[model samples]
Target: MRAMEPDRHSYISGVLVMEKTKLLYQQMYSGKVFTWIHLMPIFCSSMVRAQIQTNSDSKNLVTHKPTPTSEALSGVTVEPTRKSRSDSERPESLSKDLFTMSNLSVSDPELEKPANGSYSDVYEKYVLPCIAEFLGTAFFIFNGCASVTENTEGTGHLQPALAHGLALGIAVAIFARVSGGHMNPAVSLGAALIGGLNIFLLIPYWAAQLCGGMVGAALAKAITSDVKFFNATGAAFKSIERDEQVGSAIVAEVVMTAYLVMTVCMGTINKKSTTTLAPLCIGLSVTVGILAGGSVSGGCMNPARALGSALVANYWDYHWVYWVGPITGSLIVGLLLRVFIGDQKIRVLMT
Candidate 1:
């Protein structure tokens, strides 16, 4: 029984050892299968991690480092980007770059020639016109006052008319170089209406004429201190006489002024007129109007001239007649010129 027990124990021990060996082999086989199955996924994951690390390193290298060309270009910058730079900080590199880009020779004479020409042209067109207004007004007032003063000795209407015409003619001739010789407001207004004058300059020219006329008249009055001449009834040689010829004077003024304005429109402003002698033609027209209408209206073709003379002489009796007649005449002539002659054609001639 003891030998059988020992044999049984040995058999049991061998069985146990066999069972342990089978379990060990099974675990090894299962571990091999598991390792094979996870091999592809692990390898792929490791490769992906390595690639991500490489890309990150490349991005970091790219971000912080500058290329050689970019670094050289940045170093050669002419102007500093700083806004609060001192005068000494001005970059020579910037100046050199600008000079190179411009490609301009330092000895170029033609570059400034056009600028000089433009300046001269501006002076001729703008400055000369103002000068003419000043000089013409002075001459007109001086001559006009002298005539009035001389005629105060009962020299008759012919003397005053001749004086007015001669003064206007001489002034126009003298100032023609500057302003095209626009001495009268009515004449200027007529020119504007027919488009002979620039519309923007219309008011400015009129203002100048008015101021000049006033200055001239005042000077004339100061020169001739004959205070008795201003009085209507006190002096034997009065500046203004209250004769019974008021109605005739009014009619004559209207007709003569209208004729004068019409002549200016036809001769100077007309497109088809062969006469470029604007100053001469206008002066002649004034002379003729005076010769014709002198006896009746004193031939006041220009209202500013008449008004200046009248104001200085203190002759306000028939003042309305002078203003109403001459202005109405000028307006009528301007309208006629626009309607029959066509303002557009006149514009071309003046230009």
Candidate 2:
């Protein structure tokens, strides 16, 4: 009986050790998965941004003062020519690039008319822009949602706010030349209304942005543990606690999104306000919105972002708040810009 008792105890100890080993293995595996998911988007986005900035810098090198010729270097008396006025002394040339599209449209006379059914023209004019939107939105979502999942220490909203802001700024800068950097559907709607984007591209851009959002959220989920993902509610909107709070949540979202879209329109689409720093200004607006409205509505100023996380978490409660609020907010901003705030060239009423 004594020998039998020792064997029984040994069996129990061995089973306990096996269970612990299994648990530890799972935790380590999940941690690795989380780290990869969290870092992949960030690393990729950073690399792309760096490459784009390098190209921009190289291009700007041509604008530098010309090198001295051999005659000048040999101390020949070269006549000094009067320098042109500094940039600040002259009116800033209105930028018409992808990021600054004040009065351009699909049917603008300035744009080259492509032949009917030309696949190459269609690909260059439309498909490439949509692809840029997809990549921009995807990386932005992955970074933002992953940040939310990372906020496990009960810290204030600042962490996710900064994450969203920095991600959006980097994404906008990366894609500004290709797609105008309107990652949000609300921003696209605003741009379309203001003639900064072609009206025909609205639905396509929205679809691309939404699809990107889903992909980003899925990537975020893959990187996080089941517990953290569930706890974060998959980074979906959930601040509204009661039916009465719904009204305030809707209002908060509308106001917050209005601010975001307004910044987009003014900083990127309005010639009077457009600057090289437009992307940074727009990103800061997002950070402000999230910080101010986060407690009331979870600060989801982007419907694409909200929808992506909601789909991942399967949490549908008050889901309409995200869509209705941001769209309405953007609509209001668009109307204001078209009627009053836009430059004289683009305004519909005052112009």
Candidate 3:
């Protein structure tokens, strides 16, 4: 259930069978399960009719009617009908559990997607996910900013970089399924570019992420006593050396943001990715971004990160670099992914 896990599969299996059965009875699947269940007897009767009709011309047919018995059942090929193929042939979509295995269809034509198809589903589908994005981003930036605020010892800058990486990995592991764990606005925008998310929800995601980041940064300031150091470090991203001009900083942001967004597209956004280690891959991307460009452009691959720190610390220096660079890079990768690796093309897309 979690990206970082202690192997709770057995426990979750038990809960799945029990809780989903309850949901099935309570109409969680909108009574399609009920209809399917009631139809099974009729289906079995038809199958029996077909079987008996096929066997009637056999030379070894029983001559008289008889009561039901174990021997009679033994002769009947009364298979509990499977869908399309044997259970073993079913895809790992069954990993979602039996209730959610509503169909083996290759396309959405098998059933209408939304039973209600009303505005009410907006709350369940979009609002809750945005809430999760908010809370998860809050958790992410709070810890990450804390790391930055605490890194005032003049030691190497690796600690804050690793801290942000590890913190992001943990948050991603927790919130991946909930809201794609996109603590960064650039990542959410990238998701929108392709069709993983509804276009309407993108602004809400950005708002939640930016707000969560601001809250986290403000809270981090409250926790630390060294206001000067905290303000200085937590303000915003800046260039230090080589190509310190605005153009080079923008390039750094674009390259680093592209790397991060591209990995997310391949590892998590792409349906075909078999790697279960989304947290590890995405986190390492952040770490590498920091190590590679932290000294040059401060590795602010996420605009929300820079924006939040700037807002909290009241620092507005070079804030545009973070936003322009990341948005440009994410859009570039998003377009590339859409053309070459999107879900529409079978040769490139995952199922």
Candidate 4:
């Protein structure tokens, strides 16, 4: 019974050992298969990460590199970005350019050209006539007032007439280069009709002459006030006889002014005569007319000149006759010249 018990225990122990070995073999086989499956995916993931890193490094190199000379040879131009400028910088540059241009214009030697026909050609053509009329009228008023001032003890009709003639002559001569020397409204109107001057200029010239005459009269009054010879109200040397000889004054102004306008037209616009001496001739004509009729009419051939004197002298009695006579005479002479002399010769010569 003891021997049989020993054998049985040995057999049980052997069976238990065999079972443990089989279980260990199964666990080892399953672990090996699982490891094989996981290994491929881990290797693929590592390869992909390395490839991504290499691509990133290549991109960085491209961005950091300077432009190649080969690209330039192929006609590629790489321009740098410009920095933005501020608004405050633009006006300063513009101002500098303007100042430079102004300096050049003012300093140029060509500014003193006379009839050489440079610099303000348009001003010479369109604006000079009116300017002359204004200036001449002013001159006439100043000299006329001086002539008839009550304080000038030696002044008389002949003296005043000579003064008027001299003033008219000088003014015309000075402005002849710039304008044609049309100083009176009647003369301007007549010239426009006879010489084909622009009729549009008449109104402006008349206005300017009138206004300038008024200014000149005011200046003359201011100057005469300082002199002891002037009697403002009484008929000593400064006073004009306002109440005496109304009809005689009217007739004298009409006749004298008419003659003056006619003489101006004949001297200046007549194709048969030379106008180079027109200033002197016209002035002499006015002097003769004044000498003939100055005692009766005050010898005022120009309405503007007469009006200015009258206004300053506070005398408006014979104003209408002066206007009527000069205008009538101008119109009549203009018609006669147009009919007799004609503008054909002048136009042909000019052309």
Is candidate 3 or 4 superior in TM-score?
3
Candidate 2: tens digits of C-alpha lDDT, residues 1-351? 743643454455344433433344346345432233333333343345434544454456546565699987898856544333353432222112211433322123444566778997789889999999999999999999999988958668998999999999999999988999999999999899889999999999999999999999999999999999988899888897789998998899899888988888888889999888989988898889889988999988888999899999999899998999999999999889988889997798857
Clashing pairs in 2: 34-223
Task: Tell me the TM-score of model 3.
Answer: 0.64
Q: Rank the candidates by lDDT, best first.
A: 2, 3, 4, 1
- Model 2 backbone overlap count: 1
Task: Please list the C-alpha lDDT of all candidates, in the order they appear.
Answer: 0.61, 0.80, 0.72, 0.62
Off by over 4 Å in 3: 1-120, 152-154, 227-231, 240-244, 343-351
Instruction: Return the top candidate by lDDT.
Output: 2
Candidate 1 — worst ten consecutive residues by lDDT sum? 231-240
What is candidate 4's lDDT per residue for 248-347, written digit by digit as tens? Answer: 6656666666577666666666666657777887788788887787666656667777677667667665467677767776777776666665456533
Q: After superposition, how far is residue 86 of candidate 4 from its true place, in Å?
A: 56
List all candidate RMSDs to the true structure. 32.3, 29.0, 16.1, 34.1
On residues 1-351, what C-alpha lDDT tens digit does candidate 3 reach at each position?
442232243334334434434444445344343444533333343344434443442323335446677866789643232123333432232323343444422223334455575665777788878888888777777777777777767765687688889988998888888888889999998888876678888999999998888887888788877765455566456454344477888898999999999888788877777368888889999989988888778888988888888887777777888899999999998888876766664224443
lDDT of 4 at 317: 56
